[model samples]
Target chain A: MPLLDVDYMLGLVPILLRYLPLTLQMAAVGMALALVLACGLAVIRVLRIPGLNAATLLFISFFRGTPLLVQLFLFYYGLPQLLAFLTQINGITATIMGLTLHFSAYMAESIRAAIVGVDRSQTEAALSIGMTNGQLMRRIVLPQATRVAVPTLMNYFIDMIKATSLAFTLGVTELMGATQKEAAGSFLYFEAFITVAIFYWLIVELLAWVQRRLETRLNEAYRR
Target chain B: MIKVEGLIKRFGGQAVLDGIDLAIEQGEIVVIIGPSGTGKSTLLRCLNFLERPDAGRLTIGDLNVDVTRATRADILTARRRTAFVFQNYALFANKTALQNIAEGLIVVNRWPKERAHARAREILERIGLADKADAYPASLSGGQQQRVGIGRAMAAQAEVILFDEPTSSLDPEWVEEVLGLMKRLAAERQTMLVVTHEMSFARDVADRVIFMEGGRIVEQGPPDQLFRAPQDPRTRDFLRQVLATQVALDVPD
Candidate 1:
């Protein structure tokens, strides 16, 4: 056999592309779940809700400091034994849950900083205008903070799509899982991995383009 | 009428405002002039419970709140009767100049969006910023932004408007524009408590003037009396120190 199998790599591309949807699904669902949870966690962290901030801090520290691979294995293998209801969790569900939990910890910090970055004067101005607390948060504060958070959130989303490759560890046949089988059948490891890498690169480029446009729109008001 | 009594605020154990008491009649324009750190701004803030006085009583129109025992409802009710203009032109930076003025109406007054925008546009015209309706605060000059800020307070239409050094942050070229707007509001007999350093504006526009020092009202009287024949030694010293500059402006080179 030749040292390099160019034909095998080209053939692996279609097979891996078939698995791209599954990988995209894991990332999209996990990111949607993480976004909601992160926003709540960020608000709680920003407000310093009495008696809960310590718990939140410890939770963030644990998730942020630990390796995601370790967390994924723990959630996929160790969790079902600890919780009876978790026994029904499948490989895909476990992988998504792991991704959501891990990514939310990181995103929460970015969101908290974005919220706190909103100027105090904005709060005072909204309140002085007789806006209720709800109105102030929904209308004045969040919109401004969201603009500041968009680039970071997009970075997290792109990170997540790549992270879904780890789902193979949980037995989910996403892009990486399919690539592993193709590599085994043909013993063309380099070709299999390159095919998957190209797919990821394309996805990242698409998302980065959207991020650039969004940043431009967000900055339009302040632009001279 | 707006009645404030026994207001006190402590910061790191020192009282910023100690035992402030004053009354302003309906449509009265009271200008508060004092040295920095003397609590003139703090007193105006206490009226709207912005600084949350450690102990005080504030009555704005029919709403009353005791600082020590006030409920959340009581606080909001008191806040609704009053409005504030900030020293640094705290317009909503994310919004267009017109939206900044309309925010209060849409949120607090529950006006329909179209109606609030219509009213905001009229206020923009009234403030001589009709062309800036669609411009965000960052795009506007300091004078244009400050005028939009004043229009926000005007749209609030509260029984009393508390100004916290509204013109102190402006460039010298822009100060006259903001002060001229306030002078017009004064002529309309809007109830206002203005904390400012523009002594000429105080001398010319105030219905009553209050001099504060060391967090106490040293003296208060009609502008003519407070400016020309202040009774308290602190008041006389303050006016002399501040107006010595005005005296120079009055005399042509």
Candidate 2:
């Protein structure tokens, strides 16, 4: 038996690449939904809205405390049994749901810190001028908070993209799922995994580049 | 006119503002001076309902709030009539100088963008920051930022402008520039309440100076009377400590 098979690994790269778009789509949809949910949660967390606060706290605690895989399984296998409306949820939907719920909890805290990290003066300034809370947040607090939270949010997105690999365990044939099948069919486990690993490394590199460019634009005002 | 009756605020178990009562006449520059941790800043905040007083009533022009029964709408109404200039300037870091000035007008007053921007630019010119209208707060010096903060308050057409140690966060050179702006506003007879450490500002610009310590107005009167002949011993001690530091700074090594 050959110790290594360069041809098999080289061929496996394209097989993995074929499924990369689905992986990206899963991450993109999940991250977008997560951002919106996180912002809402973060605001509720910040304001400590009466009855809603306990729910947000429970969500954050549950998501943060459990492993992502367990959450993915719960969504895939557990949710449909409990809720009639959720009975039709498919594997891909479940994967996205898990990613969004799991990541929203993390992003919410970052966004909350950014929102609260804004100077007390800024809130005072906005309020003293007669702005309602909604106007103040939309016009003053959120804009600044976005700048402060963008870097951290970008890092979350990168983590999210990688986390989409766990989607394969739910039987959604994303990149890692594609690689698992190819390796099983050819008995070239190392070749399949190395190819997938390179794909991950490249995706992270690409995202890092994008994050740097965005950070620079956002930081222009902060520079003297 | 601004009137506050029995305004009380607390933090944890300690009372921060202990039944404050005061009145400010129109076109008066009232300076509140006190040691750190005293309720001077809290009192200023209470006037506009920034730090909600636990009890009592506040009236600023037409906006009135009975602390015992004030609704959110009442607070908004009061805030509409007043403006606060923070110790740190508190300019919108994401906005240009003009945008910072125009934000309240556009967002709160519902002024058209064009009209609000025009007014903002005019205020910037009056504040001698017309050339810096496009600059972000981070790029501007502390003095410029504070001036923009002033411009923001002025643009609101507030009945009373509250300054919370406007010069506290500035460098020595920047302090005079800000004080000069405050002096001009005072000369125009803007109804204002200022909290400051600048004895000279309180001396030259204030119509009335209030000295506070331990959550109470220890003494209040014309600056001449308050500064030259403070009735309270605490006032005397605070002034002595502050003046000594000024003298120390002024002397050559």
Candidate 3:
């Protein structure tokens, strides 16, 4: 193998950093959308609201069971051919939609597990205290469930940041897309790809560090 | 005041609460005692519609609680009148003790946050947990958590509070702390329907003692009358067995 090119890798840093904002925006937008969808799906499954619950379960199962790459292609490529409306959507929007759907399925399962993890007795206690179903979920159940979900949700976010790399396949000029262009022009695939890998690793590490800090803070009151 | 008539509950094929009838006067403290699995807890849960009775007529101070017959809104209104404390001290684990106590007041009563927090603090102090107000349920000992549970119930200011084996899960040494708080609450003339295994506390704190067996009320009377001289054979046998076990455990080798 060619001697590890430190100078070349160092030079690629500024180039990759230019696309960092785009990468962060995709992850942030995807996460916000996924959170909204996940909360709805989780509540449906947790409460088992008849037809809605069945639909949510199917949504979760279908998305989670299939590979995310296929889902991305289906949204970016397959859907536009099938429907004219989707053809009007841009690559960035399609990438975000794909990321949101894929992440929301995993997030729904995580959130449902967290919600179910709360003791049944707490719900009963809330009800006996005269809380309506809405009040119980809003004031009691979700507050507790969100605490339990923080770590898992952060894990999903970290996974989401890595998953954004696949958006390059849709021709969205995110960090990975920028890296591929830079590598193709410069003919330094190894150096360019390694720089992007390092960037992703650093962000994931930062998120993992924040996750640990959050977990400790949330659990601090309970610890002696 | 409450009236329960023809209360029946079944889990699958097993009858948990066979048709039972009882009347509780306003400001009365009624202690229901029976062997485990005799549906004592079930009966208390039924009062708040936590475990809806399969067949029954429940009237809490003139409001009917047979959910099947009552409108959804009406049932909710009736449930607000009665608060329940569980064996496990079901304080929301993620919430501070104060938040747990203030939640019902804020959500159900629409009390402002400041007023709710103030009232919650007062109740926590009354329950001897003022210093632990900001602590989470997981931070407190079992006894402290149960006290917080009592405080949560008191904060709701419901007309009646139901306790289902409140101290049964406490450490033996710490049981009295919870029972003591309960005794004080009973003395304050809080309308309490308590299901407990602590015969001593029942005898001391209850206005009336009820013995349940096979899901039916077999006997009831003043605590002194029931404990000193139970009329039914089942009650006598139960008291005898409970006392004999305590005695055997206490006696030296």
TM-score, each model?
A: 0.96, 0.87, 0.94
Report the poorest 10 consecutive residues by lDDT, candidate 2 chain A: A9-18
lDDT of each: 0.88, 0.90, 0.87
Measured over the true interface residues after superposition, the C-alpha RMSD of each candidate is 1.3, 1.0, 1.5
TM-score (C-alpha) between model 2 and the true structure: 0.87
Off by over 4 Å in 1: A1-10, B248-253
Ranking according to DockQ, highest score first:
1, 3, 2
Give the CAPRI class of candidate 2: medium
lDDT pick, better of 2 and 3: 2
What C-alpha lDDT does candidate 1 achieve relative to the native structure?
0.88
Q: B1-253 in candidate 2: lDDT tens per residue?
A: 8899888899997999888889999999999999999988898888778888899888877766788688888888888788889998888887899999999889988989999999998999899999998899999999999999999999988889999989999999899899999999999999999999998888888999999888988899998888778877888888888878663322111
Candidate 3 lDDT, B86-158, residue by residue in tens: 9999888768999999988898999999999999989988998889988888889999999999998898777
**What residue pairs clash in candidate 2, if any at all?**
none
- Badly placed stretches (over 4 Å) of model 3 are A1-7, B65-67, B246-253
Q: Over the full model, what C-alpha lDDT does candidate 3 score relative to the true structure? A: 0.87
